[model samples]
Target: MKKKELIMIGLMIFSLFFGAGNLIFPPIIGKEAGTNMPITMIFFAVTAIIFPVLGIIAVAKSNGLKNLAGRVDSVFAIVFTVATYLAIGPALAMPRAGTVPFEIAIAPYLPEGSSVKTALFIYTTIFFGVVYWLSLNPNKLLDRISKITSPVFLILIFMLFLGTFIKPMGNYAQPSEIYSKNLGLQGFLDGYLTLDALAALNYGLVVVFVIKSKNIIEEGKITKTVITTGIFAGMMLFIVYMMLAHVGASSASMFPHTKNGAEILANTVRYSYGDFGGILLASIFTIACLNIGVGLTTSLSQYFNLLIKKVPYKIWATIWVIWSYILANMGLNKIMEYSVPVLLAIYPASLVLIMLALLDKWIKGNTIIYKAAVYPTVAVSIISTLDKIGISVPLLTVLAKKLPLHNADLGWISVTVVSFIVSFCIVHFSEENK
Candidate 1:
């Protein structure tokens, strides 16, 4: 591919993955991680940047996630694929994307006495309508996202970041207990919560299509190009995240303690530019969010068409638009409350799947490895999800708390490692004996 073509492709990948909710993470991490920001961000990058890139590489090398996942079992493949798509689609992400622009970016700018509920309904209708329209044709997603939405979103975000440099907010403050005590691990856990790796698998499919649209016919070449583009996308994420985190770190001394990255960003912007900052920030969020909504609607609709073959793509997109619009009207907080538990339940399994896909050559795609690693991780994640939603199992909660790195919400990691080792031993020994 030409340089210009590669840049456009990279931007498309970046936009597909960088949803507006992503804006809410880095700053909160910086705020808490404080003086230890470098170490924290390095760990954050390992999960957020590195693994997500690897996920794309895996999908590209395997030609698709379904084929890779099928190494576990066809039944598991179908179920996991559908669950992953839906979790990132209308069920959670789309609704959250529909609402987030307003909650984090736009709502602050609304005139007093305006009906927030009424405004949300109006906004999401247009948002999902555009999403549905864009998604109606998958071939054009790269054009709309990369050529139009991505550049606009990048410019607006860069404007916000630029102000932080032109005028510093304040010095980074001392970290809170968890961040100070367990900085790298906490940051590692924070990165996992981004859910980008799962999204990367889905977006990897889009990359394949985009490359084909350019007439790169060979699978190996497509895979190689995708890996290169993935690194480019990861670099973009690192730069953007580092800037956003720096903004948060700088604001810690000036602004009072804020609970989320969005609040931290808003306060910093308002301080720098007063009333007009709200408008600028709102545009950044609105564009970023709308890009993701369109990308998800397109990816999911196409997948459903392939999976079922009965329901058409447009129909699926319509269903998503309707569902997302309604759920979005329920507002951002409710959407996150429902979505977080589902993501918490699924994300560990996703990471395991990605890691295993990377190691498939070494293990020769052993079903035993996939089974051992993912099954227990899924179970632990489900219990963790239940605990998160306050439906606790007393003994399980105690066990989870005692696990290595559990304090960082990685209770499943220890269990997954042990399960994989034992399963590998059993599988290897049995084969040798036979």
Candidate 2:
């Protein structure tokens, strides 16, 4: 691909990853982290940017997520792949894409007597309608998102930043209770809420499809291009997070008691630009969510159509859009309440799988090594998620917190590393015995 094409593809990928949760999490961290924002953002970038970029690279190098996870076992490959698509697709992220714009940019401005539920239904119907139409023709996505929509989205965000610079809301206040301790860990955990890493696994193939559409067929060239595009996209995400965090921090005193980043963001723009701020924010979110909705709807339909040949791509697309529409009406907070625990559960396993794929040469495609590394990580992840959601597994939850990084909600890392080591030793020992 040419340099210009590479840049556009990077922008497109960035838009795909920057959806509902992406817009909301950063500012809340900035607001809560206050003086700790700098350190907090660095850790946030690890999961939000670095891991996501690595996921794309890993999937590209391995051809696809299913192929990468299949190295563990066929059953795991099927299960994980399906779970990931759903988690980032119709199950959570897709519904979020539909609802967030309405919540942050539209709902607040709704006429007092208007039914919020009815407004949401009308808005989402139109939202997903545009999404479905654009998704039907994935070939135009690069032009639609990167060339047209994403640039406009960036401009609106810059306007918010300009407003902040022109008239600062308030100074970054003291750290909140949650951000008072383990600020770095808190930031990292917050980044998980974006769910971009899972999107990375799914979006990598979408990028590949775009590249092949341009007739770039060489495997080596495709891998190199995809990795390059991922890096560029990661850099963009980092920059935007920095801007959003600053905006959040500045809004600290003005919107101190806000619940989530959505509230902070809406308040920031409104405070900065008066009545016009609502329009600006609404445009920004609608563009951002629309980009994501199209990318995801297209990608999910493509993947599922390939997986289940009986269901045509259009049917799958319609099914997801309808499902997302139904779930989106349940309201954003409720959707997030149910989705966060599931995201927490699967995110660790996704990270582990990405790391293992990147280290594939060392493991030499050993299924034993794959199982050893992934299974324990997944087990610990499930227990940790259960504990987080207030479900105490008998003996397991207590054992999980004892592991390193549990306080940071990263207890699975140690388990995964230990399992990898034991599996490595067993593989080598058995080979030597033979």
Candidate 3:
């Protein structure tokens, strides 16, 4: 590809990675982090920026999403890829695509006694139905709409940030309960829960599909091009995330103490631009969310169309919209809570695959080593996730409860350590056997 074409591709990839959830988290972290916004932003950037960039690079380096996970094992490749896509699509991304519109746009307008349940049901159905319809035929409209929305989203956010800078909110209050100590770490972890990095992994597949369809790079060179493009895309993501976090921190005093991240973001936008600002922000979020839904649905439909052979694209898209609409009606807060354990179960396994894929040249696609690394990793991740949701794993729970960390999310830390140890042992034993 020409240099100019590559740059445009990189920008498009970057825009694809940024979504409505990405817009919501920073401000929530900022509000709670209060006096420690800087620390929090740094920590948040680790998962929000660095991990996601690494995921994209992993996909690129491995030549495609299938190759990235397939290196682990054929069964694992299928299971992991399918699970991740579903988690990011119907279970998380699609429903969220609908929810953000309501939380940011519709929620504030409702009367005290009015039925939020009814409104959510209607809005989500229409929002995802439109997504289903548009995604059924993937074309230039997808790109054009996203191109328009991404900039508008960025501009609305910039205006909100400008308001915060020009006329600051009240002085930062003391850090909230969790953020009071080690504000940076707490804020960073909180930001990680926004799951943008996970989204990037799924979105990178779409970017790769686009690149291939355009025939911009030869088959052999796709891997190198994807990595290079991903770096540029990742840098853009980092810049956008940092800016949003800063904006959120700056506007902390303007919002009430709300537990919901979406609520905090909506309130901040309303404070910055008043009713007009609210409408503008809502429009931006709605467009951004819709694009995300379409992209996710299209990606999944394509994958299944390939995998199942008999499933038509339109059939898969329709099924996704109906299922996602049902999931969306459960409400955002509940959906998020339900997703945590699933994320915990999947994230470590995904991370391990990403790490191994990036280092594949060194590892030489060793199946024994991959199995050794993955099995224990999955076992520990399952235990850790169960621990997180207050479900006891008996032996694992007993051991985890004694750990010296907040709520034992440190379980992930343990899982990583154990995965390495197991992989090393397997490699050593296998070499001796050979």
For residues 26-138, write the lDDT of model 3, one tens digit per residue. 76777777777777777877777777777776776665567777766688878888888888888877888888778768887888998988988887877887787777776
Q: Which candidate ranks first by TM-score, i.e. highest?
A: 2
| Candidate 2 C-alpha lDDT tens digits along 264-330 | 8888888889999999999999998998899889889888988899999889989988889888887
Runs off by more than 4 Å, candidate 3: 111-118, 139-142, 171-180, 217-220, 254-260, 330-337, 402-408, 425-434
Which segments of candidate 2 are over 4 A away from where they belong?
A: 177-181, 330-335, 432-434
- Cα-lDDT of candidate 3: 0.72
- Model 3 quality (TM-score): 0.87
Q: Candidate 1: which stretches are off by over 4 Å? A: 392-401, 429-434
- TM-score of each prediction: 0.94, 0.95, 0.87
lDDT per prediction?
A: 0.83, 0.88, 0.72
Pairs that collide, model 1: none
Pairs of residues clashing in candidate 3: none
Local error of candidate 1 at residue 202 (angstroms):
2.3
lDDT tens per residue, model 1, 251-369: 88887568889899899889888888888888788777787888788778777788889998889888888888888786557766777788788888888988888877777888988
